[model samples]
Target: MSGELLLVGSIPLDTPEDVFRTFGEPLGKYLFAMPDGEVGPRRHWISRVHYQVLAAHPELEVVQRPAPDENGVERQQPRNAADAWWFKVRDGIDRVRFGDPGWRLGYARDAVNSYFVFRTMKEKGVLPSHLRFQVSIPMVNSVLPPRIFPNRKDIDKVRPGYEAATRAEIAKIVEKIPASELAIQWDCSTELQDAYGAIAGYPLEGAIERNLIEVRNLSPHVPREVALGYHFCFGTLGGWPRFAPDDLGQAVKLANAFVAASGRPVDWIHIPVLDRSDDLFYAPLRELQPQGARVYLGAVHNMPRFEKRLATARKYLPDFGLGAYCGFGREPTSELPNILNDHLRAAQIAAL
Candidate 1:
């Protein structure tokens, strides 16, 4: 009996149709829900979309552009400081108000569009009838990151509007898609980074509490019938992991906070696992209080250490789903097959 499998949103496939045929068709049996692969612009994660949203705000101005890379090419919307275009409140503007005229975050639009394909594929039997269409959305802090906003005051000014926009997006999604056919996973990278103190100038004090407040705010927007999950991430913007923590202590603590703060029942939680196989690293998981939500450990990568990591993780969490540390969107398209294979193989190993 294989354990459950979770796909962390982005897939490297070119289109929703391809993702459905490729990932959904094969992995459908192992998965409770599936994403549209977050193709095209979303393949780079939320950065590209966020850049567009922030750049369009009338009160925001580009204060600094990313320096050119070694290849002498400067990315217009880089994910990190090294490649990101920094923004600030425009001169004479005391407050930054996003979505003033109306902000289009695009998650709802994309999810609704992709859902059509998902429904079509299921009808055609290319996907399992039981699989819900998963929409992976970035948390507010992730979209308006400290790296891009820099100033905590600017973040404060922009948060309400962005959050309102997010809630509206969720409203549209729930209205268009049936609750039973949908699952929403809030991706948390910046929040975790702040909690870990990895992001410079981002205060660690009360970081977990702040993140919990976000969970409380957004999780309620997702109707109780629509499956809700949280993806605790370290980010793969600049690399596989923008920051590697000493252990799972902070991640577990943060996960616990999110679960407790969520106003509604959480269907699942995805916690990324580093490549460490040591007991000390996995021990923190023992303290994870998941309530009634299913837990998925992202211990699929770093194959050579897979067994050790799984064995250690099992000692603390005897029953949990398996997933990659992050999405496959940033990986080379050529690696998709192997990545899929790895998930399947990891499931088999977990069953043993």
Candidate 2:
């Protein structure tokens, strides 16, 4: 992991190359992730993407029901529930059928556009030729269907169609972008939830194995030449973890499972380190040894004395690179420079 700095997808900027320019060569020289700045709200990042896909299908319906509230009374829908739409299969159709859902989905289109942007930057000497364009796609089971289908049975019924559509999306990206120039990252938020038993619908028995099966199935489509990685995250909103992990043990176990089941050469793995800057959280890293993939600890943040956080992480996992706990897309645009500076400062410290 020497001379490496990882961007954990998305930056609070206007364009992709702006991420490189803001950080300048010192930070970008090692590694760069195409900023998903246009992704509107942070919590709704995948929700918005799901909305786009659900809207195009005539058989699916997006209806608003009462918003769940702490007290029984319905309150105004939360922002995530407000703009984000859910899916419903048409009545009389016993099963949902997908015919070329990839054409209607925009995951490949976005990745392809970002690839072109990276190529332009590299050709103009704005980015190093070694810099790879990382495309982060949410795992199919991670976000959409659970929101739309409350019952596990319903989710199971439609899961295959949705997964196939996502596989198709990956196939499209692999077909269009040169495998060498691209790196595909599977974002595993909900899978983490399932691992911790934080989310319902997933059966208690063999939940982790079932989740790994999804990764094993979806990851191989990237082709052996293309770089592949996994981002095991707890949900993030407004620059904070939705559910703080007691420890990273579950994430560590999950990473080990993914690497074992992936059956492909995983280039890297990103694990979130919450607001805590203590040895207890980093302790699990000692046991986590992903055979070939380099590990990046999401130990960087905007908190005061955050460098100590990086120091603590280095103390436990000395060879790992640094990244934010999650993407900074929902953070204030004015904070972008400071966040970028934090990364630069940490990189400098690590290089020492």
Error of 1 at 280 (Å): 0.6
Q: Candidate 2 lDDT, tens digit per residue, 40-123?
A: 332245755445555566666656543557676742223453333556666665555567655545777777776777788778
Candidate 1 lDDT, 1-352, residue by residue in tens: 3229999989988899999998888889899899999998888876666557777778887777667677988665464656676778766777555452222888888898999999999999999888999999989888778777656578777788778888888898999999999999999888888889887875788888877766778887789999999998988877878888988999989988888888899999999999998888899999999998999998989888899999999999988998998898788899988998998898788778
TM-score of each: 0.95, 0.87
Q: Which candidate is the best by lDDT?
A: 1
Candidate topping TM-score:
1
Off by over 4 Å in 1: 1-3, 67-74, 77-80, 100-103
RMSD of each: 2.0, 4.1
TM accuracy, model 1: 0.95
- Candidate 2 local distance difference test against the native: 0.71
